[model samples]
Target: MTLADHHHDTSPSRPTGLGALGRPAEVRTHPLDMTSTAEVDAVRTALADAGLLGETVRFAFFAPEEPPKSDVLAAAPVDRRFRAVLLDLATGRSTDNVVSATSGDVVSTRELDPATEGQPPIIDAEFELIEDILNVDAGWLAALAARGIEPASVRAVPLSAGVYDYPGEVGRRIVRAFGFQQDHERDHPWAHPIDGLVAYVDLTARTVDRVIDAGITPVPTASGNFDDPAYVGPDRETLKPIEITQPEGPSFTVEGNHLTWQNWDLRFGFNEREGLTLHQIGFDGRPIVYRASIAEMVVPYADPAPVRFWQNYFDCGEYMFARYANSLKLGCDCLGEIHYADAVLADDLGNPVTISNAICMHEEDFGVLWKHADMFAGSAETRRQRRMVISFFTTIGNYDYGFYWYLYLDGSIELEAKLTGVVFTAAADSEYATQVAPGVMAPYHQHLFSARLDMTVDGVGNAVEEVEAERIPMGPGNEYGNAFRQKRTRLTSESQAQRSADGSVSRAWHIVNPSVQNSLGGTVGYALLPEGQATLLADDASSIHDRATFATRHLWVTRYDPAERYPAGDFVNQNPGGAGLPAWVAADRPLDGEDVVVWHTFGTTHFPRPEDWPVMPVEHTGFRLKPVGFFDRNPTLDVPPSRGGHCS
Candidate 1:
């Protein structure tokens, strides 16, 4: 049933929900929202008492329970359960478990398969142990000594271990390590990249498996310092401070996980797996997206050098995307009246670790939404545009990514990924890279992100169609031919839905409700407008191509399954070929008017320029979701004109 027609009952959810990480004094726990810190503690205690959690068990992911869409939409009495992916450090076995927060009873438990499925994410403790493992390795020390670098003078940066010709590490947990010549404590380690050295550190054994030294490349001596006044000179004094004040407070209200602004209502959630997700996104009490999030993201470096050839990092699946979220500050990170939600996630030891002020929510003004000047009537009408922004920033290795989800007044949704950070550099020069600094080359790479939209257009019955603008043939029995029409091909199956974006044709995918019709008798739908860029650039035979099959296309639609969450399978660490999206679509399930989930791959193909040296400028890549026949008219027509927002 459509929210507009079904009394649009929220759980009294006009306010935003609080996350489980931790909470302020004013915030209260919402059961259907994110898991509470108390819930985490209680669940962990229950598992340990029940012998489900041993000392060797580490938590790869722990967060609030996701109630079935049926129970949620049907408004069933949902139980409070927390889901977890616990890893046995001794045997490297990943177990998926569900425990009730109230009764402390195990709801379900199953051991996962790393060969057929995927490996669990690399826990934080493994990353913390890289330097220790590297320091004790004689092979790694010999390689560093070959480059005239000592153990104390260099830093070992932990990196994602990509799949390659490593038979010894088939079933073991491993993390790649790169050497950086660090001259001092304050000196930037990224500036002095000691190229030709690699360490395959096994986390299970707590030792460096082996070292791959291609050859000694000259280590760059130049400094890439952005903080020091000596290198950066002085702060810009010419710029004026821009202060934003909400005189009457923000338009959005947050009560626990629920967020409501104007006619839009939704609940926000955070976890150690996929950072921020919106649940039950409804506009004007009409359901649009039941859940939405960046399921997985892959950063494939194009450098083919032997030392760096296998450098594709699955940031979410392998690195734990939410674990490294930046604690946002008030003035620097955000402006205006902001409501911050903390994300309490389990650490490696299954203990609650709080990331305070991780999620930032605020409102912004965007020029004009609608304007018309009827000169015949000698009058004009214009209305301002505003959006509620829910965002979080994650600092992963050499890069920091800002995931921002904006809900506009025009009933449009946008997910913009703000990329700004230090580029990964190497000492050797290569054609597949850009020389950002003297003797240092930054590899040309692409950041491909996949957004999984588990859509509930009106209810559960939804369909997708690929719409393209096409020009009619001039020979179509016309003396003067200037006609063009839209070609909308309904996607009926998973194989047919594996599509790409074509900007030349102005292509877009619309998710429509086959059962719901608008006032014009057209189907009520939402359009996925892509900011089309190059997809995966690697050859079809490449390792990353097979592992990251989802990045090879623009759109993939599959019948909704509760277990099919991650795009590139669950365990991304050392994932083999044909495990994720490609494997899931082997059945080619029917998508015509079924419970379908849309996976949209969009990204930025970055070729670093000289200006992108130390700290790169923010590069943006995203897609927009706009209403199509979902409303009777301009929904913003009732929006009041901004007070004194125009000239006389």
Candidate 2:
């Protein structure tokens, strides 16, 4: 399903009279759909009715709603319900409330201790309070002035405050903040690092708790501006313009959020947490994936500098970076025939806001799908390949990430994350960083994205098996040499299934519906092929190791549980350790003949070079899912060949 749209007009997917949500009213809201702005007000009203929400308590987080049980989803249409978390500023306690949007009633409530369960995700209101908090604190201003940078030169931006063993920060809603010098009005702060100055702002108290100045390292004066004319003298005229025109228009059709292209049928939805998510993916009316999304990702820096050591960001869970998703531009972000879908989400004040053309969908010609030349028959046949692309881009701090989902003419699903942006910089003395410029050193980091694939190959009763190409020894049955076969091992349980990508052995994990069979009498399946890059470089003893255990392995298979959506647990803001996947799979749930979800960790470990300075080029990383036993034969035999159009 594709949602990448290039148009920023007041356009929506479908006509719906119900509020500002793009989802059509008749099309019943899927459990994976985004929480509507109308539902946010209904939830606030419902909480107030139960005397849990008021002036003293602030809405901390309304996380991505969890679905009902597996059976309930396959049954009749269900009513709309939501679960929200609120923090009492007076007592530093979080109360979880489940509200029914259908009836506008509060169904359940539970109070959690910040000391035990970690604090809720950072809210938008809390970020808004930072400027006021910093402006009032004279110490923060003095710290900025001490670095020879005015307080007005840097903005008081709030960041996801990670956890250490600090006694004062324990059990508090903390947001780590720092400053970057902007000498001019349009200066990019990322280029100039006001290093060694950090502040811990307590959101609950609405004050700057403390500011740490680890001796001011020289602020980088290099200009990081790439768009300005001052950076480049002239434009290159060597490259000519290429036009991609589908005069007949794209083959894909969209009705509301539902998308159908070639033989594939799927639906896509968006939320504040995860920008774009796909659901109900099927090929020729046979189910493949029930729900799929980029559930969580961690960007952990390897530098050990005090100001940079605690640099790990959970972009989706902690910051809800999707709120900052870019409204894609036409010729630049997408080309060819495009279909755009407008995304709607609630603002900090529970008001509806629409990011027009936030999602983009397009098609691209991909060389050839199949080709054959028969010398005996004096005939040649070739069929070109084309894939439908669905993507969205979001900017978080210094980096911008683009998550793309591509569906091909054949039964294949692929997710590609394009990384491009200015790299986070520090002073040039660190051993773990590369001095990209005279004074700017970019640290080494990894962007490990955990893709959650809720697969239902033919049905929910599916299992995962690790497939590897094993080399047979040169003996026994083979007296000569050259004997190799594949070894398939059914992952029976959760703990035993934790594995790494071994490209040396050509390893891949396959999700198969063992209960179903194809024409060859083999189990219907799809294979997950990873690029097999390195996992988290952080050791098990590090704090980030505990918070992002999902990155410890390339693959993790667990029985489908609606509650287990996030890989790094629910509250990853300031988690200590052992909370998410590591804690959930400790029970070692059996995965045989059960509905299972595959979390594939795929990313690149960046060691910045001189060419990566200023603005870095796009680096690509992703995984693929191809039909294994699901198809009896070639699925694209009916595809027509291109007509003759040659140029001299």
Candidate 3:
């Protein structure tokens, strides 16, 4: 039944029986909320006692939806449960054991597909081992000495998902070492590269594979003058922090995994692959999104040279997205009264490792939301825009990507990613370099990211409708036809939903529940608005093309499946081709009036400019899913006005 049809009141303060009559006014804690520290420890202890917590038999959090649908979760009894994914490293067999956190018992067990075992995340042990090799290994030390570099001057960071074409044993992690210059106390490491030399470490073998120097002349070290007080430019002075005070209290409240802001509510969680996930979202107690996450991202380098061609990487599938999370500093990554959420990741040995301040939640001023000046009335009305920002940053090799999910008072949601940090460079002659550096060529590349949005609309089973604004033909009506019309088409199946952005025309797709209707008799839905998109430029027959078939389409709609979390398949490193989005959608399942997951691909084609040298500024790109006919009118019309004085 539609929310409006049910005349029942569902406010949290007053209990109301629910069974399609209406849902709860307040949000409930999602079963998929991030596992807590005690829960992690308890599960670890249980597995340890059962002799399942070892290097070979490891335990990981298994994300699963509760038996009952999200719409009925409020009426259902509280059943706090967790599942532990047992992965056998030797045989690669996986099992799912449902762990009752409340009862502290393994309630049920089931076997999972062998391919369901997620790739081991890059852990502290891997980094520590590489550091030990650089310091203790005689050969590595000799190579550094030969380059006239001291151990203290060189800083090594893990370069994950490095191209590995070696004929090696199975289940070995090949980590590439990227060294940085650490000359001064205040110098940032990325400002200098020792040049040419790279160390390959075999984590499984616990040995340095080989140190090879590419045949290229070493370029001069870039300036680390960012910290130098004398090297100041216009607008270089640091600005003072503008504090946002809450005289009473915040307009939001967090209860366990559920957060309620104004009229919006959502449940958030963190996973190793997807990083931050928002589940069971609602506005005014009406279901909007069932689940949403940054599913997978592929960064492919355009250079065709031997070493560079294979440098293409699927960051999410290869290296765990959450393991590389940047522990955000209070005044740096976020501002104002910030709420921090820590993420717990399993180590190589399956122990729970907590990364503090991995996700930051805060509110920000988003400029003017709405303004009108009625000269006839001799007055103006304006409502200042403010948005809640949920953000996390991950440092993958030379690049730091800030992933932000913003919720606006206007019932709009935005997913934005900012790419900042040093560029992965190669030595080149001054003639070949035009944009990034004189002697160093910052290789042409594209960062393609896919956001997996599982929309439930009012509840489950939503349909996708593509709407395009087209100009009306002049001859059709035999009159002055300087007008446009909207062409709406419903994508009824999976194959029909796989679409590309037709940028020439104004178009948008919506996830709508056919049963729900707005006050104007329009289908209630959220519009998928793609901003910037960069398709894969690699040859269709290329290896990189096969690795990431999800990039071929701008949007992919598929039937919801818990196992199909990743776009580029489970294992992307050194993988010729296996299972991915194309293979998963080969079933051609029906999508209309079914649980659907929408994959939105947005990216940037980075042709590095000269200013990108040293450290590149943050390049922003992403998409938004805004409310269309979901509401009766402007959702922000009732927002309170700012009481602060305006500057003349």
Candidate 4:
């Protein structure tokens, strides 16, 4: 059936028993009281303005009745004590509270769809809207209170649908409470929280009591002590005994020997101003030679008698002797000059004697010295006086993974530079604003900037593998890409504009340099051309220059090199150096072309204060380099950095 045809008449039959008994038979209905007075007027004005309250309109209120008794022979009387009023808009009879208390009867039927055109049913939609509006009002009310305001903890529960029986009065109450009018087509933003929930006015704090009676639990306090009880009733089942053990000593004794002047030799040859003393000897019976001063002065010695010590030593004499012999033979000083005399000596019968000098050394110092010796022995060109080197300097924050330096070495002209750390931008923090144009300052104001360098080595004009590397941020404010924001600035001017026929279109450009210092006022590094002219390059240009433009890009840092201009143990104040620039080289090596300078910096950008512990995050920064133009165009560029490999 069509929508209009589905409308069923629900008028109640005339009363019987009450009129027959002559019990003051006046039928009347009372008006439904709206929570607010303003809502009633608003509904009246709205209905009148919409032309729904004139001759063609009619409004009525009804309370549903109980089912009839089975034994009744006569029709039961309508419950006239339950009153309702019908409005005949045609006669303009719209008086307030005009219904008398003696009318009751309502029609009931199956539910019908409410989406009919030109005549949408208001039952479900109106109740739903009222509920939502009430919820929003409650939220606003809580917000207005001086205390007990909890935005996250607020909630709403609907009461009943019977309150909508007086639509006109109900509508007025809602309008007065929320300062808005109800319209099927227009939605108000303030009404969002109240939608689809029942509205209730708790004049006597009855709402809370009603809610409790309906079996809802109250919300727990946010700061209630939940941990105290938990600790008092700790579970013993989860406890277990912990075992401790004492640290054991070394497996064997570390024996050492000393060299004497007897292992020296005098040389008298042509053009010899002073005789050069030499020591010829054997290491565990293996022949070796060393300078007399190095042999006599560099070896360690103890006070114990040699034969007595050897006899009194613990078991495993052979193993101990072998370890001692191997360690002594391999030991060398910072210059890579092996002291063979310490491991060898003159035999009693004119044959070379073998001496043992083996002692455990600190891992860090030993590593440094070992590398120094290896680099010196491998390259003959750097055997003479070492040249001064230049290095890069940067302070990375504590959270940084590490720094990277880009170096270009082609067995010819070498150049080096570095880029700062990496920062990542998250979508949650990024927003699109209608007020600002896309790709403008507003979009990138807090955006993070990072660089990825891909270097390829070409061999015989053919492209080989490419090496990819990334630098990441290291300190506080790193979580939101703030670290990058502090070190770089986006060019928002027309300088980054692209030329068009009509005019110029603005394009975003990232310019990176040490000029953009962090709050600490210390910059990462400076850039200079081959001619020593300094200039800041665009981010893309910097990447390309570091990758393939230069013959060799040296990634150096300014570090305190104690051996550069002072004795081994001389004290020097920490400074950038007199010249403000110096050659960058690994600590263990002499500055030379044979070794590619891999630079690193170590220091605090800002001095620590008493408040900094438990060691606040410090800013540290550095760079990395891949061989771009270093080889013949492109070689095996995909090789990863070696864990134990030195540049030389």
Candidate 5:
């Protein structure tokens, strides 16, 4: 028997029912019914098992690049045109609002000519295609359910043009058209551009179910010492009353020299020193600050068209205002004031002494000064006088987390004015400079000299100390009587790196006494060293003074980390106890005893409101510094009166 010759047709005979050719074995398990909740759950479960849950399962749909082809393109025959007119007459009104159109509106015709039709058969065809696509997607979902997959949620977004331009309204329209309701209604649209139209079905097990039932109701009336009546009275507001959406683990504690606070259950904190608690305040409260409405600010610049312009104008305005408000409240000002003068005196060793006491202002004032400089730079008369006005301001807020306990969170603002832009001599170019003597010279590098201000938090409490100092080189300079020149190198490398990386570097500069000498027979001004104590020698006398110093101000804020489960949102870190402080205080070189001064102002931040949620509106508030004579005269005395009409 020739076994090899025996051939049996064993191609796995097709099933009696629908075979793989009709429907794949996998898809054959489920029917295309989308109404059943059980089917939906099954689909979600299947998707989760396949690791296609949440963001991974969204389906994106793309339109064909080319338009559909037709057999006839020339002018239609008389009968065909007439038929098109009849179809158009019937469906013309239905086309006004596609949202209301039904399956019946879909008209199939062999006329093949759209020119004669009111409902240009093309539109009906397009509608039918859309319906088919939707049905197919629904079937896929049903199949997933039959596989025992349950999806978290199915979100359908229309990828048609003009949909994203007005998201808030368009999103609502889509929801209404699709017969789907949003868990929470958002005033503005949340749609963003993707590669194409896609339905994202999130099927994650972690879903937020804890609902905060009580709405945030604004207090009709409140009064406090702060003039703007919007301030909630000292004892009025309480975080305990409001229910937080999510409460997490035990409270965390942050302790520092000037401030300390404990995070509580509601994401609020209790300030130990102030005996008050901080709550997340929203924009709905009293007008604590001056603000510009988005409509008033953006309308004039938008198009005049009734619908499109207003809608766009409002959306644009909200977005801009939100960003501006957040930055103004939370961002830090790093730029410091520059000072210069006529004849600065020097000490015996040629170091510049009596550095014509100039005031350093905050970044905001510096911005004003910069603007003024630009406007007045063209004036020949102003340039000749060399009369520079150095401007800066100081900001103070309750010690980090200080607002946690207090009823009224507050910040003080102070403006400082001084003359800057005056040119000074570099240490390398001075005649008074000398070679470094091995044993006698303290250090060849640059030295930072500062003075300490010791004060007690309370009369009975331990003395809390703060340091202030002026940075000046003692190596070469003339006293007030002589025309002395102070020489400083351009430090091309450091300057270039600093300029290029502006605003990105976070570490502060540490000032230390120098010990090395260069071949040029001159000592480097300030030595770059770790944050630690260094002795300051008087410009004239080689006497060294030992001073204990630390950072007086640090940029600290409350931020939420998505990973943490504790008080939901809380402050995570406070960087202190370092020698090199923030850049606002000059780094790279040490300051002369008179160059450094410690000043502070305060500020507050609040959560955004529903009105502010889509786009926040701009708000403004300012603080005034009483005449403390930090300057020789009232800094604002010389300021010219504002051009009458120019006041904002």
Candidate 6:
């Protein structure tokens, strides 16, 4: 019988509702929610009316602060307010802090003030201007001709040329060109190479600063090797679309910016800073995490040569991830019945611009969640696993990072970061570029990213516990030395919480609410289960190390402070280093049974390989926040088996 044929049977495995069981009374549009296109345009008009428009002044979102956000979520009446950062780009730039603006009327007027130079949002217009310049570069065409390559055969991609402080330059629109081959009219232009040719353009001077043309290296060509037909397995050439059918329709509901799926509920919003943020996260109508987002990321290059020493990149702080958001396509980046979300941004003229399909939410069949077969009972039981995925992707220059938040059937939450796209390669000297190529070295680098998790486990008074499996001596209790004991240690303060991942022991950290207990007398909590290679390998004294001290350890718990958002202070591009996580944690604040924030750092050290040339395959790293004693029993045990029957 088909899966749907057995729907009439009232089996234990059959799910009742295809959508939310109940709606939360307090659930509504978040005030800190991303500024709408209409609101953005209105704000722009208001700023102009106030004489705040100039070439030297730029706009950032006026988001709601923590107090207002908390008040609104608590169902308490709050005045509608918004905050934004205005960057002063004038020469000399004597200002010590970022220009701040607040608006009581989101549509009309705003009050401006200067405050502690917090993390600044990137200039969106600059990237648009770069794209315009590269599309019509005569100099680039001539350079390609000089190298005996036709213009049509090459595809030039504009990359943000990092600031190195050249002699006497202002309003400088710096961009470098990386060319790809378009042999055989294929869409995979990343197959070929343009060697190492650099170009600098000044918008103010309206001139090309310099064109450094290096020696020509053999073009790395790829036409048939990586395409669909050849890349497929033997005898696997049919291109039929695999469909995911939800017989009862989707188990989710989206009303405005808020979404409810099964036992989980959350609000999603976008901004020109951190891209996507999940707010007011709840499970089974109870609050869990107040807010969760990717706070900041730093990708530091190891080569210290003059040409590459200053290659450290603070992606979230410097360029801002929102500017690089990719408009994902269906059946490519995601599958199933996809629900798309659009984002509104400002154009070069401070007008509203809409990016469609910027975010996608869908349900995925996550294989088998739980199964048990007993020969004595002559019975087999299993339930198909399912998960809800909320994802958005951003392509920052040469690399692409996909941010995903998953809600599992068993009350577990996972945050995943997927790294893909082309590697940042440089022209190498006669010294070997290793096995990849003769004159190209994909410099070794580390990508360290941290997520700000404001967790409220059954209200705000929560404590952290570090539990480890320790091996004891044989003399203890006159027992065998083979036995390992469970050691539970309470992290009473921030100083004790700032620690590294001890791989030698089987350990876990839990954010627990002592006031809430399960039937077993265990505290209600969620455990932080760290995964992947998360520690930063850089030296302690380096600039990268100093700025990203948050990366030194796998996890850190601190008392919640609104100002302490980003771990790598705000001005990360060529920063002097003395802000972000290290500065915040240096105070050693109390963390027990108070509103606390958890910072998780994870990453990888990439050493480029030959196959990694052109475009590298995607590599992933992430962690999970699983329910520990939060539930009285195994929640998934009651999940009904699939009507399609068991797989034997």
Tell me the spans in candidate 5 whose CA falls farther than 4 Å from its real position. Answer: 1-601, 605-617, 622-627, 630-648
Displacement of residue 468 (Cα, Å) in model 5 is 19
Can you write out model 4's per-residue Cα lDDT over 1-648, one digit (the tens) per residue? 000111111123223233322332333221111111122222233334333345433333211111122111133443322111223323323221221123211211121111110111111122224334444454444432322333332333221111122333322111112111212232211111221111233311212111111111122121111133442256558768543221342111211222221111111000000001122211222111111110000000111221111011100100111111222223221112222222221111111222222111111111121112346556421111111111212212111121112112111111222222221111111232111111111111110111111111110011111112223466665665434221222212212111111112211111112222334453212121122111112133222122111111112211223122111001111111111112222223322111111122111222222222222233432222222222233222332333344433
lDDT of 3 by residue, 1-648 (tens): 000011112222223222231222233354555665445545455556565556666553443324345434555654445556665645545566765544445667766542223244344445655676677777668867776778877777655543334555234556667566677877765556555667777665667877766644554465645546565355645888677766665667777667888788998888766788887788898988877888888888776553345566677766665666777888788877788887766555544566678888888778898888887987678888988888888876667788999888988889899998777666644332333544556778889998989888987879999988988778867468888888899999888888888766767898898988888999889999887366888888876787788887888999987667778775565455546788888899999899898998889988888787667879999888888898988988787778775511
List TM-score per model, in order: 0.93, 0.92, 0.82, 0.14, 0.16, 0.80
Which of candidates 1 and 6 reaches a greater TM-score?
1
Q: Count of backbone clashes for each model?
A: 16, 7, 1, 60, 64, 6
Candidate 5 on 410-479: residue-level lDDT in tens?
1111212111110101111112222121111011111121111111011101110111233444445634
Model 1: lDDT equals 0.84
Candidate 3 matches the true fold with a TM-score of: 0.82
- Candidate number with the higher TM-score (1 or 2): 1
Of the candidates numbered 5 and 6, which has the greater lDDT value? Answer: 6
Worst window of 10 by summed lDDT in candidate 6:
1-10
Q: Give lDDT: candidate 3, residue 443.
A: 71
**Which is superior by lDDT, 4 or 6?**
6
Q: Give the per-residue lDDT digits (tens) of candidate 2, residues 1-648.
A: 001122233333333334332222443456555555556566666677678866767666664465555644566465666667777765667888887766666778898767656777776666667777887788888877777777777755577777787888878888878677787887777788777877888887878888787887898888888888878557888999999988788889988788999999988888767779998899999999988899889999998777677888888878776776788879989887899887766554434467777889988998879988889987788888999999999877678899999999899999999999888878747889899887988989998999999999999999999999988878979777798899999999999889999999999999999899999999999999999999999988888898899999999998888888889987778877688789878989999989899999999999999798888999999999999989999999998877564210
Candidate 1 residues lying further than 4 Å off, grouped into runs, are 1-31
TM-score of 1: 0.93
Residue 212 error, candidate 2, Å? 2.5
Query: Clashes in candidate 2: how many?
Result: 7
Candidate 6 lDDT at 64 equals 35
**What is the lDDT of every predicted structure here?**
0.84, 0.80, 0.70, 0.20, 0.18, 0.66
The superposed Cα distance between candidate 4 and the true structure at residue 574, in angstroms, equals: 9.7
Stretches off by above 4 angstroms in model 6 are 1-29, 32-34, 60-69, 78-80, 88-124, 127-240, 375-378, 429-434, 437-439, 476-479, 532-534
Candidate 2 structure, TM-score to reference:
0.92
